[model samples]
Target chain A: MKQVWVFAEHQAGQWTSVTGELLVAARNIADQLNGELNVIVCGDQVEELAATLKQWKVDRVYLSQHPELNFYHPLVYTETIVDLVSEYGCPEMILFGATYLGRDLAPAIAARLGTGCAADCCDLKLDENGNLLQIVPGLGGTIFATIVTPFHRPQVATVKPGMLETLGSSENEDKAKALKPVEVVKVEPRFPQNTAAIQLHSVKQKPAKESGLQAAKRIVAGGAGISGPEGWSLLEELADVLGAAVGATRPAVDEGWASHDLMIGQSGKTVRPELYLGIGISGDMMHTIGIKGKGTLIAINQDPKAAIFKQVDYGIVADYRSILPVLIEEVKRREG
Target chain B: MQPLQIAICVKPVPDPKESTQLQINPTTKTLVRKGIPLVINPMDRNALEAGVKLKEANGGKVTVFSMSPPEGELTMLETLALGADEAILLSDLIFAGGDTLATARVLAAGIKAQGNWDLVICGAESFDGGTAQVGAQLAVLLGTPWITRVSHLKRVDDKHLLVTVEDEVEQRELLVQLPVVLTVESVVNQARPLSLWGIVEARNKKITVYNADTLKLDQKGIGLDGSPTQTRDLFAPDASREAEILTGDSPQQIANQLLDKIGWSRKGAAN
Candidate 1:
């Protein structure tokens, strides 16, 4: 039986949520193919890291250790993954997080290894012929794509976070175990010379007054209809009353009315909050990507055809301008 | 400063905003292109803008190159208007339905035909294909350094330049030298508006069109034959909505109902 492998993602001592998610996917594939599941963790604390994944039903773990890997160097990580995968022989499949580092590093490793790495896959399974069938979003999430790697060693995929739910450990208890040690080629590389047209300075963050959107209990999202920066005072009024963090669409961000961090869409933050209230925004797929997992989504847009309506569980087809003040007043009256 | 030979890859895209009747035959999902309006992919505007900015800073030429179906030349005028020094519409019988890899191969040929230049810039992703893989692939094909998700070009020195990449999970800044390819993220600076002079210049210049023979491209590599993947389908999603209008006898009641619908318990939600 072909084996399954997951590249564990983490920063510092904390493991990434995607690590848990990939384990879920690994468990599913392992159950389906009746295959052994393995994990590869690259960092200084290899033994400790391998021990952490043992409880998750991992059949074996490959720890690639180096003090140099404390921080990410593309080649340092990619080369490590490439060398490890090659040494492990061909597994039926390999999975990684479709995060920022994965986007750049995964495919490059795949290219270097002369294999296909399907990017941003939402699901993965074996086809009738036993080839890997991958599910991915196409054309900016307009639709889903089923990609297949018919001819390759270790069919590869990068899966998105929040796409799968972590299963309870009890259901998958006995199947998980850490593996014996394997050879990890450690390469000490001189950092490449930097030459880009932008400067990345350390940003001084404001002290925690309220939570950022990801951590916020309530979110007030201003849509395109909110107009310019000056018009944001209205949203500010509501956000203040409701103790909510403010968010916006790409258009709102492009208009310079809000900081780029506040924008939520396919190209922006993926937020899961207790309550998400969208004001005057059309719900396009890009915008929808940010708020799907929220507990409740309330949309206020004038256009019936606005894409935001379909995504929001509760939608009001009224002018946000006319309704907002009333809503704000009501919120304020109740707060008092 | 030496002139940077900048090449901008433009794609002729279907205008999705137009009342697009993109209902594919349910069984096959291929786009019904018999009536879709064609325009330059909107993200490509960033490439055009970057090309213009690079030319302004480094005193160089901007070449607008594209491979598309018949009548794709319409965008050449727009490209010229956007300040392309020259426009080469690689419209050949063999270049039809070229996927990203094949298009890159065709584009690589056209780029090679134009001789060496300082840089190549493309949108990190296109609205049409949305693969965002082409720029990286092109860089590999050309054997150059590839930087994806460049949001800003902050500074440029003799052999090095500084750029910021808003990579979401982590924003990074790097300084890289020339002979590198950059994929402009959509979140980057909005494309600058074209001046009237640019429009007039584009109107005045004749767009140069090339066929397969003119570019001397291998027919196999320039079209669908070279593409490793296929678009199994392109169909509008079946819109599904479970809807209810919170009805009330009065406006105040409606506000309360709306709040209730959004899960705002009157007292509990109050700050």
Candidate 2:
């Protein structure tokens, strides 16, 4: 039987969440294909990570220790992974998180091995023949196309966080398999830095708010119907009360009510959060696509027929002007 | 003194929101070539903006290099309408489904086929895959220096150019010498709207399309087979998470309930 590999990604000092997500994915793929799961941790102070992974079904853990590997040098990391995987010969597949480090590291190694890489994939599965099948978005999440590296060995993919279910959804026992521990120790490497000198400077601008859109656990999205800057202020107040992010629709930006960067639609960032609240926003399908990723969506719109209603778990019909500020005050009062 | 000649790369992509269909060859299940209406890549619009701006500022000629089917002609003409001086399309049967690397190869070849260029500016990453590696990979293929995620161009001259990159840490304005490839992100400069007169000119002028044999590309480097990466499978994310709604007699009560869920015990702590 073959094995599957997950590259444990750590940068500076933190073990990225994608590391566990990728490992869970690898474990899943291994289970489906009747293969063993092996995780290769390359960096110092990764001993605890090895044991932690065992709790989640990692059969064998490979720990590579080196001081220089502490900080990422792409060339060094890529070469080390390639060497390790090559020695293992034929792992059914490998997984990496689509973080900056994984994105930088995966392709170079895939190229060296002359294998096909499906980068930034959000999903993966095994075909009837146990070949790795990958699901990656095309045209910027417009279409999810299926691809296969039927001829290649160890099909590799990098996936974003919050997309995959690393652990079993309903499997509560946390049952897993642990095999013999394997470790790799390589010399610290000094590779070339593309830019001549790395420069550092601080911005005089005030620090970012407690919750930016990317960091927010909850988000309240408004649409063009909100009409003016006052609506934004109202939304901000509500967000402050609940500690949520504020998002806008395209029409809001087109009308000069908010910055385009904060717009939620096909053209903007994909946000996934615990709670998504919409106020005065007509649910155009474009805007609706961005909200389904949330835990539960509570949409408020005067237009009962707004497209967003179809996707949300709950809906409210009213003019946002009357509801938002009062809701904020009530929330604040309750907290107080 | 003439400003350096430039060729900008662009492609046609489908809008993500629109339902798109591929023309499939009944026999092989491969995408058929005909009847796919094309639009300029959402990101390449930014590349065209940078190209036109460079031409206008430096008094240089802007030529667009495109790789697509014969329909790619429309994309080039659109770029011309956006103020490009000329446009060329590389339409080779062998150039289909070429991933970033292979796509970069044929594009680099297309530019090389045009003789010499002082600078090549492309959209840092296309919207389709958002790889952003094509610009850097193209630079490697051309054996030139590449600066990516460029948000601003400070100055441009014969010997060198300066641009600001949005590095992970901070704003880095680097003075990279000429004989380099620069990728412009959408944030860099907004592509201008096409004007009536420019549209008329673009419609009237013809675009040149070069096939595989015309470019003399290695057969191994132009199509799906030529690509090092493959599109495995794609499906939407499971947007499912457990949500606990707060129930309270009043708005204030609801707010308090939410604060409790967020693990903040102190009332008024958030404000």
Candidate 3:
């Protein structure tokens, strides 16, 4: 039988949410191909985490535990996975979450294995020949491109978080309760190598106010319409009341009104929040692509025909300057 | 310390502000390259700036190379005007439709033709391509170590450098050895604008253009033919959406109505 593998990403103490999503995605593909679904979890003292992975529909979990693997060292992690593939049989498909590590690691693994990898893919399908079809947005989400890697084995793709939904555990629970028993096989891990050249000297977390935009549950974003610091201050007041993170359009960042880290567009961070409030953004293709599949997009722009209005769930075609202060007051009153 | 040999990769993309003018050719599976003005990708300017600063501090030469149409020579010249000592343009009709992997292979070949280099720099990703794959692919093809999302760098010695990389969660400072590739983040540095003296100096700088045969590039390893990934279809995404536009004469009335539409109440606002 063919095999589908997912790189179960975890950092610090918790498993990233994308891991669960990938497992759900992998299960569907594995069933379609009548293949075994497996996972590779690499970390020090992560056997307990590996055990948790076994609770799912996975056929096997490769737990790579080494002192050097305590943290995510790019070279060591890539070498470990490559060694694992060489030892065991190579899978027909590999998927990763399009996180910072995934973005940095996917291409290297693809190059090392002499295969093709589609990065930040939004959709995946199988061709008649069983090859993977990677659907991506190009030209900053202006167009959609369906890409295929027909010649390469173990077709690889890194999917952005929130693009795929995690299959509920209730179904897995039922399967575990009935039918054939599933015992998740745990395989040995490869030894970590090549740790001398790159040294991790220090890691500094950003202040709470400025960090975690991608992982935030709520966001208030501004665009070119937000003229200057005063406009940002208005957005900040609203954000403070709503307890939402702040993001910006490319032009806002270019104009020096906000930092690059807060920029949300094709060139900036891709955000998927429960509530995305775009105060002044016009919903250009570049900005829209980053938040394409987000949950609820509420746009406030003066132009009734702003492109963003077409993609939003609720649009308020009024001047943000006029609407913002009132909205801030309303939110404050509600919170009180 | 030995003079550093830095090679920066740049791509000329249509000005993002005028992106509405771009069109995808259905038959060719490529952008309709006409009339739209092109500029050096915004992040590539940051990478070039990083390269130039390293050269300025460590005493060496910074060479830049770009793979685009012949019109891209102007972009390469602009890169020279920014601060690079030499510029190379890889352009040919045959190299027009290559994807990121094929482009990386061509760049790897071009970098090899330029002799030994201590370091290579590139932007994290391009706005048009939006694929942060080239630097990694290029490093793998060139058989060198690489680090992406690098925000800061300092030369520690002839053989080593200090780099601060922004990972997903935290910022890490790393000590990377020579002969490594670094893909810089947008926040790496503020790109320096062109100066009168710099533009004057660039007038005398050499801007070389190389084709397939000149770089000794294998025909099978470049352009659409060499690319492993193929774009089967390209089309505009559906923009039609069902959005309810709220209306009210006053800001307070509009705010109340908007709150009602989004299923939010005064009590529910408590986060």
TM-score of each: 0.80, 0.72, 0.89
What tens digits encode model 3's per-residue C-alpha lDDT throughout A102-183?
Answer: 8888888887887788888877778787888888877555677888888877787898776666666677656655444334
Pairs in steric clash, model 3: none
B1-271 per-residue lDDT for model 2 (tens digits): 3476877888776543342454334333244435555677766788788877767776888888888877677677888888888888988777887877677789888889888888888886664557655665666567565666677774544666677664222355567766777788777877788899999888766677777777889978668888766554434434343223345565445544544554444464331
Give Cα distance to truth, residue B28, candidate 3, Å.
2.5
TM-score of chain A of each: 0.82, 0.73, 0.81
The sequence of per-residue lDDT tens digits that candidate 1 reaches over residues A76-187 is 5665676676666778777888776667666665555545667776566776676777776655455666766555667767887766667666654444443334333333
| RMSD (Å) of each candidate, 1 decimal | 4.9, 6.7, 3.5
For model 2, the chain A TM-score is: 0.73
Which is the winner by lDDT between candidate 1 and candidate 2? 1
**Candidate that scores best on TM-score:** 3
User: Ten residues in a row with the worst lDDT in model 3 chain B?
Assistant: B262-271
lDDT, residue B164, candidate 3? 92
Segments in model 3 whose C-alpha atoms lie over 4 Å from true places: A167-195, A203-220, A238-247, A253-277, A289-297, A325-336, B238-240, B248-253, B260-271
Number of clashing pairs, model 2?
Answer: 17
TM-score of chain B of each: 0.81, 0.81, 0.91
lDDT of each: 0.69, 0.67, 0.82
lDDT of model 3 at residue B118?
A: 88
Clashes counted in candidate 1 amount to 23
Q: What docking class should model 3 receive?
A: medium
* Superposed Cα deviation of residue A117, candidate 1 (Å): 4.6
